[model samples]
Target: MDDIRLLPATGLEGLIAQLRSRGYRVMGPTLRDDAIVTGEIRSASDLPQGVGDEQDPARYRLRKRDDGAYFGFAAPAQSSKPVFFPAEEVIWRGRRDTAVTPDSAASASTPDNAGNPTTAPASSPHDPGFTVERDQLDAPPIALLGVRSCDLRAVQIHDKVLAGRTYIDAHYVTRREATFVVAVACSDPAATCFCASMGTGPRPAATDPATGEPSYDLLLTEIAPSDPDRHHFVLEIGTEAGRDVAHAIDTAPAEFDDQHEALAVTAHAASQQTRRITAATVRDDLRASAESSRWEDVASRCLSCTNCTLVCPTCFCTTVEDVSDLTGATAERHRVWDSCFSEDFTYIHGGPTRESVKARYRQWITHKLSSWEDQFGMLGCVGCGRCIAWCPAGIDITEEAAALGRMRAGGVLPTGDHVPTGDHVTVTS
Candidate 1:
């Protein structure tokens, strides 16, 4: 099979069938509860065809499209994180068992040890013993269809955070390794998208380091119809497995015109996006603007609801909990996704360290934009703008970063008559 091929829009059903025949549980975009979301998709008809989304600060709505194109929506309400790194998972389970032991008198009365028999006290049950077992995974191979570019980058970030050097999450590794990706280049970006500035997407660009191949097994770029009512996709095979699947379907080699139209699709999507941020310099500027008054202004509007962190694909904080049965014979431990916005998240010996909303808000954004680079060697945000559209108060991260930059250039500190002293900030009367 050629590396690049043109697949008619109808060919998508064949693609799904091929994956299922290979023992993959195919998941893709579908309309659920009035939103486009990922779910088990058996065929192209199961996808959210001819549907688009409208997104703005504190707003999201589903709209109709005249072009009957699948993969027409931007980022879904949920990212791929829930599939690999589950929101809640049981790590281990334990069971208690009882055993019997002979009393001292009973031992002395044994045939070999006792001369004359005194009535021996009945044997008693000894201390109960417990056995623990770690949860072992046996999930089926998963083929994720219709992944967007921003989300592809988000998955890469999750790999670094969960399966990196010092610590590795075994469950995440197991699921991630067993999954196959089918990424789609964005042709209809939402108003909230800023991946153009972040360099994460409108197009599929991630490459797997281990295999030196595109991160997706199969990448798709949908070109708008040249003919009034026809649509097709430019499919790029990125792995041997993808090539095998392509062989199962009838595809023609992509021509120069097909490739050109595909490029135009992604380019037009990038140009249509209204949001912007300088991803390269935001880290350094955020590190220096910790003392900026902008934190207070943002906090006043922030409910500390943790919506941003929950929607954020790169956020990895979690908490563990233990459960026991009524008889205390069975026990289980679970790891649940947690948020930095929770006051209890920062609880220390005294109390919650970040008691004020101001301090918590400062920590959340600073860690995401600045200190994340210090820890992970990359900024935490993928610029998907889920945080912006989902926030009830309409607080925008890009806007906050820009405000901080503007304040820094003016040499005006947030507090009155104050100036930064070398590496420290000082206040004056």
Candidate 2:
């Protein structure tokens, strides 16, 4: 039902070249600092070969695989979140005060200066507002070479918040429009992964029922370990732009053979992961069980370090800080990533709204799992397991969700103000 092609594994460098020739800077997973990290890549050799990662709650380790497959691992710690919505970006620069003259003062007198030079004072050349100019980050058009299925879904979830109506992030839209996502079917899912249960991935498909389109421009399924000598990659075109890139690569019509079937079987192993996050009624049930003792229990372990939110691909909470030099002549407004886990995130003028870690933890988990659907029309988590893998307290979101389900099923945790007492958690699991 789709245009499929066979790109021989040996021809991967050619494919990279094809994308680069089309004005794309490739980003892919590579081995760095004993961990697999995303880096700008030029060729297949730049990718992590013969490498696989073992990820569990609060732990991750990279090890050599028996085969030299480029995408034989789960997603790296950093996803395309940093690639698209950067961790830190300067929105615009400003000046506290500027030299003012009689001309400037006359122009600033009224909303419309009615001056001979220009109608609007802000539109004038030396206007103070004009001093605040958008900083040109100049990020090149990117092509993510080996994005995993969960990570791809995370990008789509971000699209709802950043690109959807009500508000649009100009920076995010610019990078997103120019980017070409090449998603890879995940054959190896970490222990913390539950994208299957979340209805996100194991395989990156070009079409979906809810969204009505693919999360990526091209979907790749690697066929290997069965054929010792021949490693083949089958790609499905999702967009016209993707077709253009494919045309540049040396590809043959993909054959529906045993090797192709083997790739599916390998990918299915990720879906069969023992760890599962139950999606049915999770939203409504989580909202009902907000006062459960599980919150206190989890908060006891939670250090409020904010590692979970930082690693989460879809969490987009940010704060703007006005920075100035010693003389205060020059200033710049910096857009920085913020986390709900921080007590000061909800700080009022007097003091923090969430004085205790328990309340802060409650706000984060509830907003992400339950209320996010109402706010964004989709679940916040794509089940990439980054929150679980990176949480210093090793607090598993799936386990916490499961606890909520158990509590609600037994007897709805008292639906009133939160009490610090953790008595109900003992009977939960």
Most TM-score-accurate candidate: 1
TM-score per model over all chains: 0.88, 0.87
Please name the candidate that would achieve the greatest lDDT relative to the true structure: 1
Q: Encode model 2's per-residue lDDT on 1-429: one tens digit a residue.
A: 247887788878888898888889998897789888788889888998888888888998898899978788886887778888988888999764554445655666343556455445443454443266788767678899889878887888787789876879888888877788888888888887887778888876566434686667777777774465878788777888878778778887766673466467546766557667677678987889767776767788899999988988889999889887886667898899999888889888999888888788888888888899899787888888888889876788887787778778878545553545343331111
RMSD of each: 7.9, 5.9
lDDT of 1 by residue, 130-217 (tens): 8899899987888999988888888888888898758899889888876788899998888788888888888877584433446888
Candidate 2 deviant stretches above 4 angstroms:
96-130, 208-211, 226-228, 258-263, 412-429
Alpha-carbon shift of residue 423 in model 1 (angstroms): 26
Q: State the TM-score for model 1.
A: 0.88
Clashing pairs in 1: none
